[model samples]
Target: MTECDINNQTISRPGNSWLAAAVWNNSYTYKVSAHCPLHYCLPYSTHLNFSIPNSQCQFKRAGILCGHCQQGLSTIFGSSNCQKCLNIYLFLIVPIAISGIILVLLLFILNLTVTDGTINAFILYVNIISINTPVFFPQLGKFTPAYTFISLVNLDLCIQTCVYNRDDYAKMWLQLAFPFNLIFIATSLIITSRYSTTIQRLTARRALPVLATLFLLSYTKILLIVSSVLFFYSKIFHLPGDHTELVWSVDANVPLFGVKFITLLIACFIIFLILVPFNIILLFTRWLSRFTLINKFKPLIDAYQGPYKDKMYYWVGLQLVLRVVLFAVSSLDRNNNVIIGIVLFILVIGLHGTTLRPFKNEIKNYQEKIFIMNILILFALALYNHGTTNMTAVNVMIGLAMGHFILIVIYHIFTYALSGVTRNKLQLHINTLVGWIIRLLNKNPVHQSRLDSHVMNKIPTAVNYHEYREPLVVQD
Candidate 1:
């Protein structure tokens, strides 16, 4: 063996083996991005002359291989740690509790009906006024009508126009849609861009896992974007104008097959739209958690290098787009079903916002904003629903509102709970990858060879981490 001192001073005496010693202090910390071929090519034990006769005995006496030394081999020292399973009980339990509370409230409201009390009459008057206020939609006359759908459209138009002349809700609804939709799209785009950049910048040894996570995120984003577009197109199939007169089914029991088809299409769109976003968000979150864990052991991984790494601006942009789109698309019609669909769409967008990369940082604030927005929107809806053409029409609007509320709540709970479980599964996968990386780095081929020599002096044996983990070490 040849040896050199800390200053690269080589000592070669007559007939004696050469010796060299170079102390790599903290100042010479490993540069993960740099090409340090010598350190990588030579096994640690061999380079340090730990194979000298009696060196193992000395190691034992010095307590270098004891419990304290074993700590160096801990999972914490690896590139990442295992992810703990997320507690799903909280997600499943809390919503059920809230539903029970709401059920009680619903029962109370249902049982308090009155025939002709002063307050009842007042409510009846208000409900009547609400029903008949829609001469506002251009198609509807200058006054509300007796038909339930026509009256509801009238009430919506009144709210939008403060009268029955024009579609008032259209502009606000359009504004709401664009910003909300943009939230998920923008965040997803940023995540993809940042991930690609990270892969390009990373060195070969560290690039595999980063590349894998990037691929996962990119694929997920693509799926979501495609799904979102398909869902919107599906909604367009269910035209805004009433088509009862165009019913083609021969059977009286199923007069409007178009309606049923549209309903099924909408349901499919809603399910796909809801599931895709949740799936993508959960996957990204798992990747993020893995990044966090790996960051602890290898701080050079550059978790904060991406432009979208902070992500607050991404969310704000999404909000802006949602607002614009919502305002535009919401004006096509004001049928109870249509309005409910629009509301559910808005809520879905809000839920996507909650799962965006930086959402957790401001979840409470976002929740408050969503709550306030929903309350105001609902209040307006209530006032609009009140302007029916008749008392019976007003009751129908109430039923529609109740049904919409129930559907939205149920959809939200299912998506949110599923996201949690999906995130947990992703974390577990990343953890496994991290553990593999650490083992690949520290295992010494020379030591393994020496042990093999002792076990099988005459047999040829091959065991290598690089072979299993990557395309062998590349020499630049």
Candidate 2:
């Protein structure tokens, strides 16, 4: 077909009138001729169309623009501006691509003929890396690189909102992160559930999946709650001087309350409703299991028993959810109040963990305690240095945090090295050294007199010794 004929044919195609009208409306100076084809602009447009009702526009329906609108927008605003709108998808794609690769790798590793311990250890290493990445590189917080490696994990959303004052781009990335997180969580749960019998048979051989599940679940719950608080609660119940950005929109009339926000609020409420009763039942059943009188209901109790790790998972998960909620609420406070609230919260958690020893492994419990202590100290330093003109306190806090991490690494190395026979030998040496130090420090006359008396008591009487000595001489 001739170019003129093709142009004529394209202009005659359906939806051209809407595009023409949008283009004319957007560009008052540009007049649309009947002979001009819409394809001369661009193939598509994802921008909103004000010429029609929001319900009629594709951008309003989906967060993306329709082809007709894209053409109209390009015709009016040029192709460069239109391309910028398309670049947003790159943010969505990058994380998804990375997560897809990680997920595939995990599946492959899980299928390998490896010991559960090895798999669990590998997973634990990955989880540690995922959790600490954002801590080390705060810039990646916006992109949420943790979600890809660990599956559905995120840093404190409340901190991201209050401290960072994340812009729309970050919000968009978060919105994208949520679904990918859900998919990852769901996939992990399904895979782990399939291995539930194996996991039970192996006992503590498979802990990472449980911990990962709990961590994801807890973080997901926090994400939902914090998102709802940011998008819905903060919007409806505005606090004085509260200028925090909403997850969806900053303006009141933007109609940006999309399906995702509403779905988030609903999911948050549903989960809360379900979790409350479910946890009550678990707690009540657990309590019942402790009583000897309930031995008749052993089968029923056993059904609910789950794994010990599962219980620990729930406990740790609950702690995480509670901590996040408190932090989210406290983030509403001004000045250094949030930091103070966080320090207090961490202190309470540390005390609880120390007293309860939630983890099955004593080592894990001790490690967590040390971590909490380190975090508390760092936060305390930060709080003291807040609003200070000098960078010394900030530097000190950073240095201390880094040093604490190094200490933890060294501790793990020592712990690994001091296992089995080496550990026993080390313990004997330590005891000897401690005893020698005690003796060296007890040089005071009163302590010496008491020690000499104790040694004398340990000896036989002189009369008994003389009698025993005479017996020996008689034998000679």
Candidate 3:
């Protein structure tokens, strides 16, 4: 896989960075081009300026430029402005996630365990020289000297083991990890496709940042996955010694133990690298007021949170969460794993399409009914799961669709009716319940109008004696 020479290279965008485009050898499993020219992109610049890049968007930091001659910006997955990207992420993720789990579920159903696991290892950095090793010296000849031992190693040569009655989870997940990475690769490619090609401008640079960002995002999941498999391997196959029991098999014939050791070491380093910043952010958020957390996550739910964008974003997130729960349950050694997995699979599929239902039929009343149904669905799931009542999967699916519908509709009610400041406080405080009851029992809030009272009028005249004046005898 060599990069094409300058002679083989052609201009991509009219005025964009040339480095954005790169051609790999035929051996590469996947490829992605860029599509530029989206209006109002969150470029790594002040006010979408193309010259200077900022650290705000992860894509721009990775050198993914605009498809158009324009460059220096990227809309990230969780960015409030990039809800579409989030939707795409979830859309791709749903199936990919389900695929691996489905394979595991199948294995469970068949009661089969196939053996598969990673080579487990750790580094033993002997700061001091090793004991009893011969060291060559001019003056001190043929002396046993302590020397540091730093070596990459292969602990074992055999690769067999995906089969296990109880260990299938680890085995199946291990098998799927690398292949599952292809899903991430595909996701990155889709994001690349978002950078549409223009007649004059090249957008290939956008792929750089998109790929980088995705790789980082995928890191934690991958690390955890690989580490889990490695740990599983160590437990299953290892040198039966007190000190080296957790490491790969120490047999001399086992090939490339060094490579495996370094690989594991690098993996551990990657995990460490990934966790540092996240922990920083977590600590910072904790240090900040409670409102910071809300303000932070507000963007992902921003546009669709209103009546504006597609409700599918919210639905996708919720559906993914539910799918996770279902998978968790399915992983348990229970007969109901099949039934629950199937039911949740249907829900995951159904909820996605549920948003496509005619909006006209989803009037306010219908929406309210959806909210009520969501409340019912919760109870129904609990009851059905516990065997309190017998309900078919279809019935559960219908209930899920209705409940899913409620996600979009309930937000409107929450924002409008319940969110803002309200005058729920009493203007007039009543001391006792009896007083309020007696007060309400009266026909009128007040017994009578204050204006109905009798009234008297008087006029005063001023004179010398008492500031009163006398009238003349004009009538006589």
Candidate 4:
């Protein structure tokens, strides 16, 4: 058939008959059309008017639906009903769950495998290096190479192992270690300064030497963090083995590993840094024997008033001094750090509780505020201990800390909410009384109109209502 006739005319043929038209050209141009109404091919008359071409003209057989529909059908029939469980399945719950699992696994690996050799070496070197004095300050001595290794390469390794292998716990610790250490340093510095200055002025002696030594100890805390990170990476991921492992114990149940040993060593170095100066002070100064609680308070109260600020600053200063001393004593005997830590635990709680007392009337509001402040403090402390602590142990510590913080947070929220309700009620009563007064003063239209005009024209007075006047009383 001709192409022109095929395009214009509609014709019916047998069920499987095909139609082809060749155009008038040197080369034959064939066009094939099919009609298969049983399988709804090209088209059959339904709501729309179109013809279904015979299947015989088709190159390949056509199905009712595409491959996608087939697969969908198979899934529907073979798999469980996705729609029925879509609320849980379609949401981000699965992705979050999977990510959480992966994060936990990484933390597990980091906690179980990372070592602490580099940290111990650094601690030893810092103590040894600082022992020689100011000439070795910026210069690289024998200890300088290890210090260089930590700054240049160990940092990256710590970050990698902590972040990728240990992830959640590592990141958490890294974030917290810096701020906490800073707090400790600042607190220690303040106490040391106060102690030295007080001793010099009161006793007619120079305590600068001892104070300077105390200053040296603050830096060791930072070194400890750095060393821990380095040691973890060097031993955990880069060790000579196919499988890497982290092996620090966070709980009483678990045995301590090299990392823990390093951590303890770092703690010891910090003690030495603190004690060496105090010992020097003790040797020269008979005032050390006479050092009493009253002397501490005299310096403290002389500094501030208002119980809250006084106690806070005093407690912080005291804690710093005590921590340094405790750390020193503990170095001589580790059981001592634990005993001191227990004492500190009690003192911290007492001081923290005292802070809450000032806001007892507004407990809820106060608690919320306190919680936020504590969170910041906790964050700082955590940063200082990051790679230095075991991942699993660190995580548990953080979780418990957060729970402790959250309890206080919830308490404060309710307190504020109650205060708000009380304030609203008081305001409502004031509004009602004002409305009643306005209604009671029902003057004539002219008087009322004049009063309104006068009110708008004049400047407002200190006294709101001019209608009521009272005799003034004067006192000699």
Number of the top lDDT candidate = 2
lDDT per residue, candidate 2, 290-335, as tens digits? 6686566443333323223444433433444444444444334325
lDDT of 4 by residue, 193-285 (tens): 566876334322212222222233334454334333333221122212254334331111112455645565466466556445443442323
Candidate 4 lDDT score at position 11: 41
lDDT score, candidate 4, position 241: 27
**Could you tell me which 10 consecutive residues in candidate 1 have the lowest summed lDDT?**
30-39
Candidate 1, overall lDDT?
0.32
> Which of 3 and 4 is ahead in TM-score?
3
Q: lDDT for each of the candidates?
A: 0.32, 0.39, 0.31, 0.33
Q: Which is better, 1 or 3, measured by TM-score?
A: 3
What's each prediction's TM-score?
0.18, 0.41, 0.23, 0.22
Model 4 misplaced regions, further than 4 Å = 1-162, 165-313, 325-333, 340-407, 414-476
Backbone clash pairs in model 2 (N, Cα, C under 3 Å; residues 3+ apart or in different chains), count: 3
The numbered model that scores best in TM-score is 2
Q: For residues 1-476, write the lDDT of model 1, one tens digit per residue.
A: 33435453322221211112223543321111111111112112222332231122111111111111111221111011111222342253354345434433322222211110111111222232232223112223223333333323212222111111111112223222322333333334345656677533322222322322222222223322233223322101111333212211111112234565355435446646654444433334435545655346232222212213344423322332333243233322334433543464456546655664333334434433443343334334544654333344444554444354345446545544455456688788889999998677548787767767777977655597555575565779
In terms of lDDT, the poorest run of 10 residues in model 4 is 74-83
Q: Rank the candidates by lDDT, best first.
A: 2, 4, 1, 3
Candidate 2: list runs displaced more than 4 Å: 1-85, 88-95, 100-226, 229-253, 256-264, 271-285, 288-318, 336-355, 387-476
